[model samples]
Target: MSAPANDRLFRRWTSRLLLSAILLGVCHPLAAAERPNLVFILTDNHGAWTLGCYGNPDIRTPQIDRLAAEGIRFTRALSSNPVCSPTRATFLTGLLPSQHGVHSFLGGERPSAQMGPDAYCTIREFASLPKILKQAGYVCGLSGKWHLGANLTPQEGFTSWITMPHGATTEFYDAQVIENGAVRKEPKYLTDLWTEHGVRFIEENRDRPFFLYLAYNGPYALGRLLLNPARNRHAEYYADKELLSFPRDTMHPWQFHNKDFLNNPTSIRRVAAEISGVDDGVGEILQVLQRLGLDEKTLVVFAGDQGWMGGQNGLWGMGDHTRPIGAHELMMQIPLIFRHTGRIAAGQTSDLLVSNYDFLPTVLSHLGLSDQRPPQSPGRDFSPVLRGETTPWENVAFYEMENTRAIRTDGWKYVARHPEGPCEVYDMQADPQERFNQFGQPAVTDKQRELAAQLDAFFARYADPQYDLWKDGRSKAGRLGGAAGPAAAPPQRP
Candidate 1:
C-alpha cells in the first residue's frame, strides 16, 4: 500500500520551510519593538510525536499545528527530563535538574533540600524566567500546575498565581484551585478554568508588556478521564478513529497519573480528544490575542513540560519492567511551537537540537534580560535560531532522571542506568523508533565507549556526594531486586 497523500504533502512542504520566508504586515504595539508580551503555554507530559503537523494524521491538533504553519517549529526539540517537576525547573531556571534539583514529581511531599525558608520551590535560588521578566518591567503570572515544591503559595516571580495546591489532582469537577493566596472550588473543567484565568490575565495586562506562564492539566492526567465530564464532552470528537490508525498502535500519548500507563495503553482517539480540549483552550487564548490586536506584539510559546512513554520501546508506561528508565524517544521528545507575527518568520522548521534547558536562556535573550542570568547557567541563547538567523548550534543534548542518564547526537542516542546494568545505543539515522539497542555490538564498540565516557564526564560535574545515582548505588540494578522503594522497581513510576 502507498503512504497517505497528506504525508507526502507534508514532506514537500517541510522541504520549503527552511527555504521560505513569511512576511507579515501588522501595526506594531507601542512597546512591541521594545519588550513584547510573552505567553508561555506549558503542557504536562505531551509527546511531540503526536501532532498532525509532526506527521501524525490520526491526532487532531489544528491549533498547535497552525502555530507551526505561522511560525518556526523545531524538529529536534526535547524535554530536559522525562518526568514533570524537574523539566519545569529547567524551564524556569535555565539550569538542568541536576543543578537546580527538583528531581521527580512532587507528590504532596517536599525534598530534603527544598525545606524551610529560601527553598528552591519557593522561588529562591537562581532567578527564574518570571523573576527576570518581572524585574524587567513585565508583569508575570502563572495559572496552572506549580509543582516545584511543598508550599504552593504565589512565588516571587509571579504577580498572579492561580495554581493547583496539590501537584496533580484526580479532580475533574469541583476541583480546588488556589488564586494568589486564596483557595476556591471550581466546578468547571480544569482546562477551561485555567484558560479562563489566563485570558483574564492577558486582558488585564494587554496594555503593557506581561508574561503569562499558562500551564494546563489536559491529556497528561489520564486516570480521571472517565470521571472527568470532559470525556463525555470530547469522546465523540474522535468517534470514527481506531487505535490501528494512529502512527503507533502502542499506547495513548498522554496519561493523567503515572499508573495510567501500567495497563495496556488507553484508546488513542480518547487521548487525542483529551488534547483537543487543550487545543480548544489554546484557540480561545489565540482568539483573545487576535481580537485585542496584541498578536503582533506578543510572543506565544507552546511547549510540553516533559514527554511521556506509552508502551513505546515495549515499556508499558513510565516505570519498570520493559519500561525501565529513559531508554525510549517519546519520553524526551516533546512538542514546542513558537509564534510571534512580524518578528519570527512563519512556516519555518529547523533541526537545531534544542532542549527544555535552552528555554530560559532563549527567553532571556529575547526579552533583553540575558545579563540577569547567572554565570553558571547551562542554557544557551537560541533566539537567533528562532528568528531564522544562522548560528552555530549544539548537535548533542544530555538527559538524566534519577538513576538513568542519556546523550543524543544527530546520529545516535545512548541510554544507560547507573551503577552497572544494561545500556542502549541506537543508530538514530536508521532507527528513530529505537527498536534496536546496539551498545554491545562489536561494530559500534568504539562509538559506545566514546559516548559512555562523555556521559560519565558530563554527569561528573553535577554529581553530588550525598546522592549520586552512579556512585551511591541508586539504580534498581544497583539495589539488586526489591526494597529500593520507587527507585528500586519498575511497578511504581517516578
Candidate 2:
C-alpha cells in the first residue's frame, strides 16, 4: 500500500512540473518575436518642403503625406553632410563622413581615380547599419542607389541587394539597375523598381523579422537637368501656377547667377513632376505592407539622405561652400518620419534637434537591443522621445561640408568657416530665412564664441582622423570635375 501511494504522488508532481515549465517557456521574452521588422525608405536630394505634408502646395505626395499623418514627423531633421555619398555613409556607419572617409559621391571609375587613393580605397571601419541589424538575427536587404562605393557589394549585413553602382539618373522609363553585383537592365521607372524590390523583400521575409533599405533615386535629378527640366511631364501637370508667380528669392549675393535657371518655367514643372513620381512609389510600398498584414508589427522610416539647394540662397546644387550655402537650414534640413501602426503614436511632430547619425542608435533602441560595446559612434538613441517619454532634446544638431561647419541650437545657429572665412550667427527665432548675419554683433559675441568653441571641440572629437580636409590646404574645387576656382561653374541649362 505504501509503494503504490508513493508512486502515484510522484507521477502527479512530475506532471505538474512539466506543465509549469511549458507555461513559463511560452511567456519568456525570447520565445516571442525578437523585434519588429524595420523598413527604411530613404530618398536622394529630396527637400523637406517638397511634400504636401511639409506644406509644399505644388507637389502631391499623398503616400508620404499619409505616412507623416500616421507617424511622427521631425520638423527640424538634418543630415551630417549636405552631399549624397557622405551623408549616406554617415547614415550607414553612424559616423560622419569626416570619420568614415567617403566624403564625396562614388560616381564612377573615372571620378574615383581622379580623387586619389584615400577616397578610392577607404573601407568603412565601423559596423554598418545592416551588419549590426543582421548580426542581431534580422535578415537585411537593400534596393536602389548604393552611392557609398562603386565596387563594394552589400557585404556587412545585407543578405540581398539590388543597388546601382553609379547614381541612377531620374528617368521614368528604361533605367539601368544593378542586381546584387551585376548590372541588369530594368524597363520600369527608377522609383517603381526600387519599391518593387522593397516589396519583394518584405514578401520573402514575412516569416522572419527583416530590415529593408529602399533608397529611391527620384526628385533628385531629371538626368542632369538642374531644378527640374521641361521634359518632366508629371511636373507640368502638377505645377502650381500661383506659386510660380512669386519672385525667385536668392539667399546669397552670388546665387543671383542661377536665378534665371531657377525661374525657368520648364525646370519648375519638371521638379514638381519628379517629386510626384517619388510620392507614388512610396504609396506602393505602404499598400504592400497593408496587403501582407505586416503593418502593425513593422516600423517604417521615411527620410532623405541630404538636402538640396534647388536655387535657394542662389545655389543650384550642393557643395558650393564659397558662400554660406551648406550652412543654411534649407540646404541641410531634412524630413524624418517614423511610423509603427499601433506601436508608435500617430500624427505627432518633434522639433527636437536630431540628425542622420542618430538613426542606428534609434533602430537599436527600438528593438530593445543593448547598446553596442566600445561606443564606436557619436549618435544617441531617441527612442525615449519616440515613446512619448521625453520632452524636446537638449542637444544641438551639427553640420559639415568640406571646409565649413555649423551648429544649430533651438533659437540660435552659429557657423564658422576655416582659415579666416566669414563667421556668421543667426537668431533663428527672429530671422528664419537667415537674411541677416550677426557674427560681429556685440550683443551675441559671447554666445557666438561659445558655439565656435563647441564646434571646434566637436571637430577634434568626431571629424575624420585620416585627414582634416577642412584644415588641410587641399580644396574641394576640381574635386567634382568642375574647374578649380573660388566658385565652380553652375550647371548648364538645356
Candidate 3:
C-alpha cells in the first residue's frame, strides 16, 4: 500500500476511537458537564383544557401527555396577556405589556411600518431572555413566529433565526421564511419544516449548550390553519371517533359570521387535525432528542402561547385578539409542561399560580443562573416548586389584554373591562366556567374588595406614567382591535 493510503486508514480508526470516548461522557451531555440544553415549544392559540393530560379525553395528544407523565404539569399556567404580540413580548422580555410598551397586537397593512424601529419597542433596550441566555453561554435559535416586534430584522441574541416576517401565516405552503436576514418563499409543510430545522439545530449544536425556541403556528384559526395536501390525516380520524362537539347555541352575541365554520362538523375536526399535527411534531422532536442521547440532559418545556375558546362560552374563534374580547377562563389559561430526566419529578401536578413572566427566572434558576436578571424584571423563580420542594409560591395570578384585566386566586377570579357596565367576578371553585357573576353581589363584597385591591396594587408597581393604561384609565378606550388593521388576520403586505 502507498504511504498516503496507510495514513488515511490509521486516521479513520483514530477518529472512531475518539468519538467513542466522547460518547462515553468524555464531553458530557454533548457539551460541558453542568450546562443543559433548553428546548421551549411554544404553540399558538391552544387551550390548556384541550390536551389529553389536561382532562380532554377526545383530542389526540399522547406526546403532550407523555411530558406530563415524565415531568411537572402546571394547572394554572397563566398568560401574561391573552393576545399574541403583548404576551409574546412578556415571554421574550419577562416584562408586562405596561412595562414593555407593546399593549396591542401588531401586523396589518404596513408590516413594514409595524416592524419599523419606532413602530413598536424592540428588545434592544431591555434585558431580554434570549439575550441573557446567550450571554450565559447558550446558543439561541428561534424557528417560528416572532410577533413581538421587528419581524424582519433578527434580534440581538438569536445566533440562528428562521422566521415568518409577516408575523401571521397559518398555512405551510409557499410561505415566506426569512433565514438569517435572507428571504425565501418556499413550498414546504410548516409543521414538518420547522421541526426539521429545529432537529437540524439540535444536531449541529450538540457540542455546545443550546437554547432552541421551537414556536409553532398551529391551532390558531381553522380557516387559515395550514394548507396541507393530506388534510384528512386526523380530520377523518376525529369525525369517525365522534370527537367534535360545540356545547353552546349557534347565534350568540360573542360569535362572528363564520357560519360555514360554525355549521360544519368537519370544520371542528380539521382544527383537531391541526392540533394532532402539532402533537406528532412534538413526538418527532422528542424522539430526536432521545436518539441523540440529549434527552436526559435537555430540559424540554411545552406550552401554548394563549388558550383558545372554540365552542366555549358562546364563542367561535379564540385567542386574546379574537372577536370575543373578554378574559374568560378559556382564553387565558395555557398548558405548561416541563420535562427533564431527574431535575423535575415524574407524574407530578402542581396548582401553583404561575404566569409567563416566571418562565425566564425559573429556567434560569434550574440552570443555576437565577441571579442573572434585570432589576425591572417581574418574574419570580419557581424552580423550587417545580422540584416539588416546599417553598412559598405565588398565591394569585394576574393578567390583561387591550381592554380587559383580570386577577385570580385559588377560589375566586375578578375581571374588569373597558366601556363596561359591571366588572366580572367568579367563584372559580363553584363556577369554573365563569357563568355566574357575583361582582356586585352584597354577599361577597369583602372578597371582591380584597381581590380588586390586590390586582390594582400589583398593577401599580409595574405602572409607568407614560406606559400605564390602568393608571391613566386608558385601558378601556385607548385602542381596541382592527382600528388600524385587522387584529385576527394581519394583512400580508409585501
Candidate 4:
C-alpha cells in the first residue's frame, strides 16, 4: 500500500474504534462534549522569567505570552525537584522524588547499564497521569523527550510516541531521534518535528477525546550546547541585540560548572533563539486548535518541566549546577498557564504556591475525575482556584534535591543540608535576592527553628524509607556529585 493509503486506513480504523468504544459504554456517560481533551505543552530547562508574560523584556515569546494573556499565569508555580528526570517523574506520577525513587537524572554515564539490558521504565510501577487518563478513555500521545528510561518503547499507556534517542541534547540539528521503534538522525529542527507530529495527532484524533503531551526539549541553555551560535530560524533576529534581561553579575562563588558561558553574548543570543523556536511551536499548536474549532473543547496547558537560571546570582544552569545544589527562587519557579475558553478563567494571575506535584491532582479534578487521583499524594487539587474561586489554600511549598532540602513560606526560606553545619535562612521579604543568610542569627533563630520543624515533619510524613537520603536511603537512578562532583553517589543504607 502507498504511504497515504496506509495513513487513511489507520485513521479510519481509529475513528471506528472510538465510535465503537463510545457506543459500548466504555466512555463516560456525560457525553463527549463534557470530557475535554488535554493538550499539555511541556518545555525543557526554561524559566518563567524568560517569557514576556513573566516580565522579561528581552526574550520574544509572543505565542506563550498570548496564551498567558488568555488564561491564568501562575506567579508562584515551582518544581518539586530542580533537575530533569526527578521533576519529570513527579509531574507524571504526582509523587515526590523521595517517594518515586528517581533522585537524579537517569541515563547519565551508564545509560545502558543503569536501565539494564531490557531497558526499564522507571515510573512503570506507579499510577501515572497518562495511565489514569488512558483508563478513562483518552487517547494519549507523546511528541518529544520521554527521558524516564525506556525511550525505545512507549511507556505509561501512551499510544503515539516520538522521542529523542537520549534524554540530553548535544545539538538540535541532525540529532538522533527514536520513532516507531527505530533510532535515526533527524535532519530537521527537533522542535519543528515535534510540533508537526503533535499537529498530526490532534487532527487525527479530533473526533474523539485525546491527550497530547507536546514535550519540547528546546531552550536548553546548558553545557557546551550554548558554545556555538544558534542556527534556528530566529538566530538572525537576536544576533545583534544585547538582551539586557539576563543579569551581568559576577560569577557566583557556588557555581561549579559552565564558568566560561557566564555573561557571554553568543550564549545569550543562542538561548534567546532557542526560546523563540519553542514559541513558534507553541503558536503552531494553538493555531491548529483554533482552526479545527477545538479551542474550547481542549484544556490547553503550557508549563516547563523545571526552571532554569540564566546568570541569575551568577548561576547559568539549574540548582544542581552548584556544589551544594542551591535552590534559589529562579531555579525552582516554572511557567504554568492553563487555557480553556469558557471553563478556566481568562486574563488572571494566581499567587498561590503550587508545584509539579500538584499538577496531576489539579488536572484530574479539572477534568471531573477527582476520584481517580492516586491515594496519599502530597499534591492538593487547585481546580477551584483555576475556576476563579476564592478558596483557602496552603501558603507553603517544599523542595528536595538529593542531600539538600528546603522549605518556602510566604515570607521565609529555610535550607537544610544532611548532617551538615552549613545551612541557610533567608527572610525573603527583607532580602528577596537572598543576599544575607540569617541561619545562626539570634533575631531569626525562633523563625528558623519553626520552619525546620515544619520541614522535617512534612518530609517525615511522605519520604519513603528506601529513597530518603537523609536517612541513608539509596537512589534508583544515576545521581549527581551533589555535596561531594557529578559522579559521586550517596552512602548506602545498611
Per TM-score, the best of the predicted structures is 4
Quantify all predictions' global Cα lDDT against the true fold.
0.68, 0.69, 0.71, 0.85
lDDT of 2 by residue, 332-400 (tens): 888899999987898899878899988878877786553441154678788877776785456688887
Best by lDDT: 4
Expressed as tens digits, the lDDT of each residue in 1-494 for candidate 4 is: 22344346435544554464466365457554458999999999989999999999999999999999899999999998888888889988889998888888877545552234657777666778887777667899999988888888788889999998667889899999989988999999999999999999999999888999999988888868788999999999999999999889999999988887899999999999999999999999999999999988999999998889888888888888888787888889999999998998789999999989999999988886676676647998998888999777888999989888889999999988765435789999999888888888889879988998898899889987767777767676777774421223322111
The residue-by-residue lDDT of candidate 3 on 234-317, one tens digit each, is 666776554544454554565553445553556566667778888988998899899999877899999988777767765655
Per residue, candidate 1 scores C-alpha lDDT tens digits across 330-411 of 7788888889999899999988888888888887777665655644466778899878898888688888776667888889
- What is the lDDT for 99 in model 2? 65
What is candidate 1's local distance difference test score?
Answer: 0.68
> What order do candidates take by lDDT, descending?
4, 3, 2, 1
Model 3: how large is the Cα RMSD against the reference? 11.9
Lowest-lDDT window of 10 residues in candidate 2?
485-494
| Candidate 4 minimal-lDDT segment of 10 residues | 485-494
Cα lDDT over the full model 3: 0.71
Ordered list by TM-score, greatest first: 4, 3, 2, 1
Better of 2 and 4 by TM-score: 4
Off by over 4 Å in 4: 1-33, 109-116, 482-494
- Against the true structure, candidate 4 has what lDDT? 0.85
